[model samples]
Target: MTIMCSAESPNQPEIIIAVLAILLTLVFFLIYKRGKSTRRSILLTGICDSGKTLIFSQLVHKKYVQTYTSIKDNVGGFLIDNVFLKVVDIPGHERLRYKFFDEHKSAARGIVFVVDSLTFQQDLKDVAEYLYNILSDDVLAKNKTKFLILCNKQDQTLAKGSNAIKSILEKELNTLRVTKSRQVESVDPKTSKTSVLGEHGRDFSFQNFSLNIEFAESFGNHNKDGTNDIDQLVKWLLKIA
Candidate 1:
């Protein structure tokens, strides 16, 4: 028997080749699946103030959240192996109104409109109405959008209440409309035509929009909205992404 025994089996090379082929196939499959499911979102609106920004900042920095990460251009990123979300913060002020409107009209994956309940009542009706106008634009209504209204300054005396702000926003949004004529009375009497939601765009009033209000207590009282809560908000945003 010792005269002509072979040291290696004839099938050894075939087995090695088969094992490598199987591994290669698995890697290719994983790559394809990842390519198919990558997700990206852009959050663009000018609602950042002292408190809201804090909540947002917390969301970005919090380690446990693992949802969103900060990106270039002040945008936040929600990163998964296959999917990534990009969130943009818009400057909330009269001077920035034009640019804000322009971005809103574009196709944004989600919208977070932060409001300060303590100060919103000063001119809540007008500001809410204005927001409705931009959201109602034809281009925005049709896109996939999630709406969040951050009511900051909740620790304040008058703003601590939640239901009041929700009701105010609901009412203001419902009354918004777009008329062909600049003057309200000039709208066609015959057609009775006003741009109602769904015909042109998504109406923030029609319940199609998911509405939620979060109060960031530490937003500014503790060193500009305490870095803690901001991380929470960013985490929430990432979950949405």
Candidate 2:
């Protein structure tokens, strides 16, 4: 018996533990990668009649859509420059905007805030308020969310250009900051959710944000050349997608 017995394998338990560890690591890594890939969603938002729906239609169908007031959200998936994206067009009605933001903020990679270039001046205060709410959101700011102020309907003769839109928005936001600061001060800080915009005692500018904020022009309608002038917007989508 002493001559025939063989020693047991000394590394069996160690080998089994090593194998299990590798498998668990691989599984966690795959789950993380899948979650990251699935978060490639962009949100289209702004005031009503700002051309968000038209732009959404143009992006998905490559043609202008005659839309009525949207009562619900529009969502779709499309390929741009070989990258797939999930885009959501949230109804811009003041009552519904915050609801949409709350629902989509967790997964949104960026926001395209459409501005009705022709009517922006009239809606300047409302626009500034909506934008202030977004820029000052605690979660959005914490995440450093990207924003694109898309001045839409640029094909209209009186439509303001991006530079003018940017200048006007900055001025309006500065005024808004003062007003909002007073309101915030009246409320208890622990109960208030609004964050401060820009630095105290300094003028508000998009440059002051840690998030990437850009301005661009778009024409959801066909241009004089009969081509959709959404190339810049499409390019932005592709970059973020």
Candidate 3:
């Protein structure tokens, strides 16, 4: 004698349905976990003594960092709004030029360019140019990397105005574009003429691509001023989230 099977059973069907539901729930959870683990990285690039470390410290603690010695190409995590934000502070000193700014080209979702508005001198412009060349590479430029130029040391006697720093940055970025155009033209005429790059890269024809200066803000010097100035930085970073 054998027992006949039906499509639906009193207990077996219910158990099968429950097992299916559990499997579906587990699949959904795995997807959410993968998305949550995808981290966002912001690169901090600038000349030395430009307060890159200070800015990172301030960002981590949501205040100002008065006394941190310069940090090399180092990675650190800081908590902002309960989410762990990763910051890579590239060394800005002239001596370490080849090490951080030149050889290593890491991918970054955003760029925080620190500028020492107070102590900034003419020579710093050269450093800025070098940075532009590195970041504005054909591949890197294509990335939607946001820039936050922190014209720090605003409380000092020699602090430059926001407009001045803006001029310098725009000029440098523009120059980098022109330099790239000339190089490509020399190498590949089609790319140089028909090619669209930068904000202007082949994406558009009539209008030229421009670097979006997303945010420009001031930060106080440690000796005289405190982290009060960094409130704007914090706000800007939060806006990105």
Candidate 4:
């Protein structure tokens, strides 16, 4: 006379577990896609006439491009060893350079700071200042972005090698740190815009940073056979990508 409750199915628990596993898999797949999409960018920047445009073109087209001064950012995407990368060539003109840096700072996976190896001595201070700014940037430091100090124009006989460039830059950055310390001391702490490059009381070096900083030589311009030393840079990009 009284109605009886139906017994639960044995497969009900298995079905519920399968549903949860599928949902978790979907979440992980989405996260992997988002990370891959956001992490494949490299920023190319340095003083004006440092061969960034040439390197950009070479990477994109496999040939040197005859470029006038770049007034704005040059962005391109290419594949290396099947990994896609978006390389941004930020104009090195003093007035326009920083704007691009601010825009792309968070998206950058690595930074290529080009130096005209032939003219490095004259431009040493400028290069150091620019690099110091990058090393001290809160976003870059926090992200631990990889930095490549590319000694461009290395095909030229007078072009400095990567070792010389590294040594000179380290020395110059040390001096810059001392000078910046004095300037910071003179200004009100609240109003001072300068960020310290390295440890307070020690000499400045790339090793002091949380990020990996590397130095390498590259010749963006093609040789007589239409090849260049840009392969080294491409290798680095592949590694980071």
Per-model TM-score, in order, reads: 0.58, 0.80, 0.65, 0.81
lDDT of each: 0.51, 0.83, 0.63, 0.84
RMSD values for the candidates in order, in angstroms, are 11.4, 5.4, 7.4, 5.6
Q: Best candidate per TM-score, number?
A: 4
Can you tell me which runs of candidate 1 are displaced by over 4 Å? 1-39, 44-52, 61-73, 78-83, 104-107, 176-194, 197-221, 224-239
TM-score (C-alpha, index-matched) for candidate 4 = 0.81
The TM-score ranking, best first, is 4, 2, 3, 1
**Among all candidates shown, the one with the greatest lDDT:** 4
* Local accuracy of candidate 1 as per-residue lDDT tens digits, 1-241: 5788668657988999999999999999997555433324555443334243444444444432222222222556556334565655555555664465465335455565666667777767656755665555665544434555555666667773446766676666655544332344365554334544333354334344423333222233445333333443455555555
True-structure Cα RMSD, model 4: 5.6
Task: Summarize candidate 2's per-residue lDDT along 1-241 as a digit string, tens digits.
Answer: 3677788867988999999999999999998777657677789999999989888887776665678788888998779778777889998998899998789876777889999999999999899999988887777766566789999988899999999999999999989888777777778665323445887667888887667899999886644235457888887887777
TM-score of 1: 0.58
lDDT of 3 by residue, 8-94 (tens): 546988889999999999999997665434435666777767777767766665555555445467677766677666777777766
Clashes of 4: 0
Between which residue pairs do clashes occur in model 2? none
Give lDDT tens digits, candidate 4, residues 125-207. Answer: 88889988888788887666888989999888988899988888889988887778668868857534445566655777777
Clashing pairs in 3: 48-92, 196-201, 196-202, 197-201, 199-209, 200-209
